[model samples]
Each structure stands twice: as C-alpha cells, then as structure tokens.
Target: MIWTFVNNTFEPEEKATLQTGDLALQRGYAVFDYFRTVDHVPLFLEDYLDRFFHSAQTLFITIPHTRSQVRAIIAELIKKNNLPESGIRMIATGGYSPDSYTPVQGNLILQQQPLQLPDMARFERGIRIMTYAYQRDLPAVKSINYLMGIWLQKQLTEKGLDDVLYVQNDLISEFPRANIFIITNGGTLVTPAHNVLAGITRKKILEFAGALLPVETRDISVAELKNAAEVFMTSTTKRILPVTEIDGIRIGSGTAGPLTRQLQEQFIRLQESVTTAPYSRA
Candidate 1:
C-alpha cells in the first residue's frame, strides 16, 4: 500500500481524496513540480521545491506548508512508501472554490511511485518529433494546463512521432515536456531563450556544457534547426536525448552525434556524483 501526502495529512493512497469543487478539477487551475529519487534520496529536491513554490505564487495559490514542513512530509512519505527508485510529484491546486472559479487556500499533495528511466537504447537510437505552431499560456509557470499537448497525442500516434516541438513565427521554442538544443554546423551549441519554461535539466546542461563547447541561449529559427549538425532535448526523465529526426528529415547522420554522446557521459557522471554524495540543500 503506497502512502500519499494530501491536505496536510498522510494517508494510504487508496484513501486519499480531494474535494470535487477544487479548481484543479473544475477549472484545471493548479501548479506542479516533479523530480526523481535514486537510492531513496530525492535528486535535486531543493530545486524542485523552489520551483513548486514559485509556480504556486505565480498562480496566486497558497501552499499551506512551510519549506521545512514540506521537506519533512516528503521524507515521511518516502519512508512509508519505501520506493528507492521513484518519481515524486508536488502539486498545489486552488482549493475548493465555492463558486468554482475564485481561488482559495490551496491543497498541497505529494505522491510517490516507482519510476523507470528510459532505456539505453533510446539514447543510442534517438527519437523523431513533429513540429507544432503553438505557444503555452504563462510559459514560465508549471501550471496544470497541458490541453494542447494532450490533445495532440492522437496525431503523434498516427504520425509515428515521439513528441511535439513548439514553434512560433518561424522560431523554435521548446517541446511540450522538454527543452530543445542544437549544434550548428560551425560547432556551437544553442537553445531557445524566450517564451519557454526554463527547465532544471536545461539549466544544469547550460552549467556544464559550456566547458565542453560554445553554448548560447537565443532564438533559433526553424531553418537553422533543420540545418543544424545535431539536435537533442533535455528533461528530468529524458536527460540528454538526441533528436535524430525532425518532421521526417534526418538530423545530421540520423543518430546520436559524437558531441551528444560526450555530453550524455558527462551528465551520467554528474548524476552518479549527486547520488553518492550526502544530500544537501547547498
């Protein structure tokens, strides 16, 4: 029986429930952040918590627990669930609204479940994605509004695509769940800089990839992306996944490039270091 943290109380997952009038249910108004745990230790948990708080603030929803209190709850949940390798989600939803529109004190719910990281073959073979011309509302906030992305799943299955890369005005923005990166023919690394969620994996890549190659965050036109020497995406789950093809056009040699493999190795080393080290807020 899995344990969940809901409404300031710990309960069996089967017994956990939320009010029907929650804004998250009626209006789909909420914010969430997710991170994985390895060896029973939450990876980059502090960063995830900070982002959760920021998202809740941006949505005008209040999380009742303090930071330390939230941490305590998470630790307790992990203890009860006993899932060493797992994904943890922290959600703050606009509380039960009397009128079903106005925001009230929100509910902070935490859940844990076993996680399966992508296979090594996915990194080796890479993925193909289709392009879509849509921008998310309040792209900076981690809101519970994935309507367009969810609705496009049918197209993805029909088209045999892995994901959607969002673009606007001929400039590439991001994937629905990840951030895109490109290696120019001239050997420079580039990613989008505006009107997209600045993901934590994207941030860490920027920190380390600079030492490996020239890195830039700027608008990348579709023409530039299609013509790039290599392409890839970064996310909490996907990590540094290569984009072998875009819209049926192969990127470079149609496989993970040499530079991408190098960065992937570097990312794994960083993950191992974090996993073995003592958990710290620093």
Candidate 2:
C-alpha cells in the first residue's frame, strides 16, 4: 500500500521499514481502525476518524498527523489510489523502545486495500454462532490486539458455528467482530450498554429506529437472548445480519425476522444515498 503524510508528502521506503527493538518483539502496544467505502464514497468516515482519534487518546499513543491532517491524507490516499470501493485501515504502533514496558516513539501506518464482499448466502440463511467465556480486553477502544478472537475462530468453526459470541458471566456481550442486538418479547431492543464497542452501523440503526422501537441499552443475559424474538448483529463490513441459530437453538422461528429485514432495507437505502464522487483534497 502507498504511504502518505502531512505537507502532501509520500514515503517511498515505508513498505520496507521494520521495527527491531523491544517494542517490536515483546510489547503489543498498538491501536487501529478500519472502515470501508462503497462505490467510491466513504461510509461514515467522520465517525470512523473520530473514533480513531478517541482510541488514540485512550491508549495514550500520539498520532503521527493531526486530525485534520490525517483526514486530508485519507482523502488523498483514496484519490491517489483511485479506490472506487475499498477498505481503509489505520494503525499506530508504540514504536521502538529500549525496554518493552515503555515506548520511545510511535509509528503510524495507513493502508487502503481492496474490499472483499462477504458471502451473501450467510446473510440470507443467517449464521450460527457459538458462545465464548472470555470478553474483549478494552471494550471501548479498537485495538490491534485481537488474540481472543483469533484463538476462538477455529474452535467456533469446528463446532459448526459461523462466529463466536462472547459471554461474560451470564450476560451475552457481543460477537467476535460485530455488535449484537436482541428484540425482546415485549418489543424492546435490548443490547449491551457498556463494555462493548459502539459500532457505526449499530449507532445508525438505533438512530433510524428512534422512538419507533423502545431501545434499551443494558446487559442482556444469555437466557434472555435465548428467548428473544429476533437476534441480529451489526458491523461496518457485515452491515446488519440475522442470527438464526445460537449454539444449535433456533432464534425467532430460525429465520430473519420482519424487524431485522426492515432495518436491513433502510440501511441499504442509507448507503445508496451517500455521495461517492471522488473527494477533492481540502
């Protein structure tokens, strides 16, 4: 991927650079954010960048560029690459240090990669998910450390589950890569309030369903989830997908419910409404 920075600069040697010190070998102090676009228009870019800066602040990692500068760089990167539809990932490493415990400097890397469409069959028939005992380390910040998800993927697949849902105590937290929501029997939308990443698509769905549905953001028990009329998950890449079965139990007639399908249609319309024309550098 091409690397660019402030002052309208491009780095030719960034691809070959590697960290050799303690931070590279031992410490795993890093954070990142990934967002994608469709038909050339960035999907919720402002929100993604805002979250990226917030994650940086929470992790105490200094970004290589200022927020505005980074935004400009992103726009330029998209233009230079002529990316019509792609995924953009930005990473910040704690940098090389004499000791693993402390960082000497920080390195920032941004990449724009081709977007890979997910299997549409999974959405139509819904996916099966297995529950995990562990929860995310930093629920709020999007970090590069994803060991738990990595470790559980194979086990989940082997168990005939498409994904893993993290269960802490009796509460159903979230899926490995998506935020979850359940439609209760009382028609309330229940989901984990705290200790979960606030997904961009999740936020938008809540906004669109405002006042139309009684949205309750709180801890939902696994038992409560089992009795849910409809269960769904949201993410940038996955959009809104129904969870038809969880650990062999069918969820809400074992098919995509009416509410889930309604929201999915709304989401598609919202995506199509965004401007996809190439953005000029600001």
**Candidate 1 TM-score to native:** 0.97
Model 2, 114-172: lDDT tens per residue? 78655667777888887778888888998877788988878876787788888988888
Locate the minimum summed-lDDT window of 10 residues in model 1.
273-282
How well does candidate 1 score on lDDT at residue 11?
Answer: 84
What clash count goes with each model? 0, 0
For model 1, how does the per-residue alpha-carbon lDDT over 64-170 read when each residue is reduced to its tens digit?
A: 88989998888888889999889998899999889899889999899999998888898889999999999999999999899999999999999989999999999
The reply for model 1, stretches above 4 Å from the true place, is: 279-282
Query: What C-alpha lDDT values do all the predictions have?
Result: 0.90, 0.79
